[model samples]
Target: MFQRGPGVPTVEVGALSADAYLLDVREHDEWEAGHAPAAVHLPLSELIARLDEVPADREVHVICKVGGRSAQAVQFLNAQGRDTVNVAGGMLAWAAAGLPMQAAPGTEPFVA
Candidate 1:
């Protein structure tokens, strides 16, 4: 996928703890399909307007169906002076890595 944003860092799914606050930047439908139970949902389209929802003091680890969107987001957030990083490989990798997720009842978990 895209290399981490210009100066932004990345962390593998395995390296993160449940305590990490994952920022899922996918759309509403994608998020509804499945997402990390602990992740904060803020579609990229709304990120700028919802900046206050993200913790300024914490390092936000962003993700999407794949790495592209999240990498783009990392660049934007960094430019805004927010501490953020791309979760390399994104949700696809996160699922393959066997991370915890919450899907709609009766729905099979998959990156949307």
Candidate 2:
């Protein structure tokens, strides 16, 4: 599939390292529903206030339910001088690629 936003740096699921720093920009429920096991939770809606939580020493890999919000986050983060990349197709592709995920206890892992 084509990249989601103009000038948005991107990486596909296949190229992602299991140890890569991942940022999930979806809402809490969506994150609880399922997300990359190593991902950091920071909703796009709360991003500005919680910007400090983002790690400054590493390249941030961002994702959303789809590519939209994460693309926006990448743009914002890059503008703020954080090296970041959008996960092309976001969680949809993440799940399709069989990437590891974590969810609430006793619940199935899935993209919400």
The C-alpha lDDT values of all candidates are 0.85, 0.90
Clashes of each: 0, 0
Off by over 4 Å in 1: 1-5
- Expressed as tens digits, the lDDT of each residue in 1-112 for candidate 1 is 2234466588888888778888999999999899999888999989888878877898889999888888888888887888988898899999998887888889876788
Best by lDDT: 2
lDDT of 2 by residue, 8-82 (tens): 999998999868999999999999999988888999989888888988899999999888999999988887889
C-alpha-based local distance difference test score of model 2: 0.90
The root-mean-square deviation over C-alpha atoms between each candidate and the true structure, in angstroms, is 2.9, 3.5
Clashing pairs in 1: none
**Candidate 1, overall lDDT?**
0.85
CA shift of 98, model 1, Å: 1.4
